[model samples]
Target: MPVWRRYLVRDASGRMVELPSRALDKAEDGTSPIPGFAGRCVDVVAAVLVAERGQSPQVAEVSFTKLYFDKSGFVDTGKRERMIRLMLESVADKRLARIPNAARAEAAVRAGAARLQLADEFAWQPGPAEMNEVMLRLDHRPAGQGHTVH
Candidate 1:
């Protein structure tokens, strides 16, 4: 027995495009260019639903962290400080708890920097990050028309 499902998504010009089952069923989000971060951050989500390799979910977080925080093994010293500052500002503008699981990687960078900083390079453990993900699920409701009582 075979079950066939068709996914139709609106494309860039506000037109609906039929998506192949291969794109929908893949583990990847179908829009991510870097293949990590769970496809939740605005930067990553710009593409939306990217394909995923075998990389772990944390690859984007750690990769960007390293790029921003670490010297990157080069003498240039990189944009670490500026990146950290932007993160601090972004967190201030956005509420971490409100960002949702669909965008975990971006939310963490923007809101969870402090936590991620503590985790740092090679020191990050999945426990706290995982806990936060679970918490994001709280108070969730299916998106649709709203009902109001006067």
Candidate 2:
């Protein structure tokens, strides 16, 4: 059976909007306008999930990442930089080690960034080189302790 996940986008006022699975794909194409800031925020969250889980971009996942990158633009901006800093800090927290997997950490980063209205850049993108870097870094750490990259 196919699994379906409910993705939520929240406005500045914190009202949640549920997006259809199809919307995520459209957003990735860059053809459709992002529904709104909230929807775009949710898309970032989904992308983080996909990256951390090592999953291929399901239509929903790619859409979220595309919207996030498009709106937030790249780093070199204060907001995006701060978001990455915050994400790194969160990954270093001891409490995160108890969580067992990267997916939860990714979700937390996404939610926290949304709450802070932080910009989302391609900082989370994991290419082969990036993955290799991550693995090398993890190899140097104690077993079962690795920084969250997404």
Distance from true location, Cα of 1 in model 2, Å: 2.0
Please write out the lDDT profile of model 2 over residues 1-150, one tens digit for every residue: 233543444346534345554665555454454535422333232322222244432222222232343452221234445666765654453445566577667767666665344334433344565345334422333346433443
Candidate 1 lDDT by residue in tens digits, 1-150 = 222333333234533344444543442332322232222221101111221455212111111112211122121123445455655655653565565676756665655655555335312222454333322322132345232211
TM-scores for candidates 1 onward, in order? 0.20, 0.30
Instruction: Return the top candidate by TM-score.
Output: 2
Poorest stretch of ten by lDDT in candidate 2? 57-66
What TM-score does candidate 1 reach? 0.20
